[model samples]
Target: MPSQDEILAVILGGGRGSRLYPLTKMRSKPAVPMAGKYRLIDIPISNCINSEIFRIAILTQFNSVSLHRHIYRNYHFDNFHTGWVQIWAAEQTMQNADWYQGTADAVRKQLFEIIATRAKYVLILAGDHLYRMDYAAMARFHWEHNADITVAVQPVSKDEAHRFGILKRNPNFQLTEFAEKPHDPHLLEELVSRDDPQKPYLGSMGIYLFRTDVLVDLLNNYPLDDFGSHVIPQAITTHTVYGYDFTGYWEDIGTIRSFYETNLALTRPNPPFDFFDASAPIYGGTRFLPCSTVYDSKMKNVLLAEGCCIDHADIQDSIIGLRSQIASGVKIDKSIIMGADYYARTDQVDIGPIPMGIGQNCQIEGAIIDKNACIGKGVIIRSFPRGTDLDFDNWVVRDGIVVVPKSSILLDGTFIGPGSKD
Candidate 1:
């Protein structure tokens, strides 16, 4: 069996999260604020730390400044600890002048740096996913099976199977074939890897554990752009590939709707993914701020972070992020209020006409109020109808969810969503 030190973790910070735009417009996908306080990148990094696999490298390409800052401030290892986390951004080099084409290409460009780590196995992860797994267990599975590549898979229903890379495995759990988002019913029926009728087909989770030697060989020979689109299918034919079934809560929050729903889901009595685990706690930035203060507010099922002040507001089933300020008579429901990055200096009169937080008597529901947005007095923001996709000067309605972009200014009495006449 291989120890945790023998494996290296490579997290792919996806390229230009177009699906999660406006949020990804300013920061990288992983850097997007998640669950009120933590960034999406924190999930994978925290999992690695909890599993005692800390020699990690994140491959980033687009909009990475904020992502880089978060990593630098949160994940610094001490001198005594042998483990370290580093970022490998796409660059123009003498060998290659293009940006990362896809997942495999990103890793391929950084192959020399990865090879220098000299680890026996490489664990690849996607940064935009929400899940908790003991990767050390996966490593053990790979070692026990003597597998060249092991993909972490989850079962999807027949209807949902077409949206994923379906896998077929033999009785011994070794992968025999692969299908990339096959829509044909006959094809899906043939690819069922499990006995369950509801979710019989095994879908790839975009998580792969590769023998270092085998990964090097494949990348050198395949010259493919994507791992799911090209590499894994080819590896099934030439190398010993296996499937590791993971039966747990996993979500790919790569789009606005998924991200919105996932954030609000945390406000439930029992969230699908637990963050309160003491043994495997999710790590994040240590901002030494004062406790959140509320005054005569009616709140329920809300996840409130530090440095927030809610005054006479009615908030339910929402996530109020750090340094958030909600004035009196404000009502927020099923929304994600990503609070301001910094507090508005009260001492400075030069602060703009509209403050940096939600103003008095504002009504926000089923929306995502991004960081540093100033919602003036009596502003209204709500979810639009299904298939509602429109872009305004300061906000965007995507997938029926109204999103106020970062550092936007919604003037007093501004109307958005349903009843608004823009």
Candidate 2:
């Protein structure tokens, strides 16, 4: 059996996340804010910790400043512990002078450093997913089946099958065939793993477990660029690959629409993915900030983070992030307010006339206000119909949701969305 210590997790920090645009404008997709306080990268790292897999490496190529900073502050194994978290950014080395071509190439470039860990297995994970998984259990299954590679798969419906790499498996859970985003009706039917009508095909969750030696060999010999497009298909033909069924609430936060829906889903009364699990708790940076203080706020099903001051606000089905300041008469519904990085002090000079956070009497609906956004008083921001995409100086609409990027400033009485002037 594979012990927890013998497993090294290598989380892919993803490419230039063009699908998740303005959110990825300043930071990488993995570093994007999630739920209220945690980041997308935090999910995988926290799961590794909970699974007792301590040796981890994060492969970052795109904007990774925030991701690196978060890891430095949040994850620190003490001197007594042998565990360590490494950030392997893309570098132009003597051998390779190019950036990470894809997921496989990213690991191929770092194979030298990864081989030095002397671990028995390597767990490949995606950074921009929302789920809680016990990787140790998957490791045990990998050992029991004596498989060279194990891919984590979840049952996805035909409607959702077009978005993921679907696979067909045998009764013993061995993956027989794999197809990347098969849209044809005949091929989709052939890929069905179960007899269920709703969810028939098994979609790859972009998670793979491999024997360390086998992984090193495949990357060295194949010269492939991607796992989904190239590597996995070849591996299935050559290696003893198996599928581990995962029936959890797994979501890929790859697009603007998915990101928006996933964030708002957390505001539900009983969310599919809850962060309050004490046994397998999600970990993040420690700010040591005071508890949020809400005075005369009519909030329902809102996940408010720490260091926030909400006074006389009517917020419903939303997520207010850390250090968020919501003034009186603010109305926010079905939105995600990623709070400021720092609380602006009254004594601080050079700060603009409009204060940080939402000003008084602002009406925001179905929008995502990124970090450090300064919305002035009487600012009316709302959503538009699906397929409505427009870009302005301060904000942009992608998939009908208004997105105010980081450090954006909206002037007093600025109107956006439905009836607002561009």
Model 2 per-residue lDDT at 419: 71
Which regions of candidate 2 deviate over 4 angstroms?
none
lDDT of 2 by residue, 1-422 (tens): 55999999999999999989899999999999998899999999999999999999999999999999999998999999999999999999899999999999999999988889988899999999999999999999999999999999998987889989998999999999999999899998788899899999999999999998999889999879998888889999999999999999999999889999999998898888888899999998789999999998899999999999999999999999999999999999999999989999888898898899999999999999999999999999889999988888889999899999999999889888787777
Please identify model 1 stretches exceeding 4 Å from their true place.
Answer: none
* Residue 42, candidate 2: C-alpha displacement in angstroms: 0.7
What is candidate 2's TM-score against the reference? Answer: 0.98
lDDT of 2: 0.93
Per-candidate total of colliding backbone pairs: 0, 0
TM-score of every candidate relative to the true structure: 0.99, 0.98
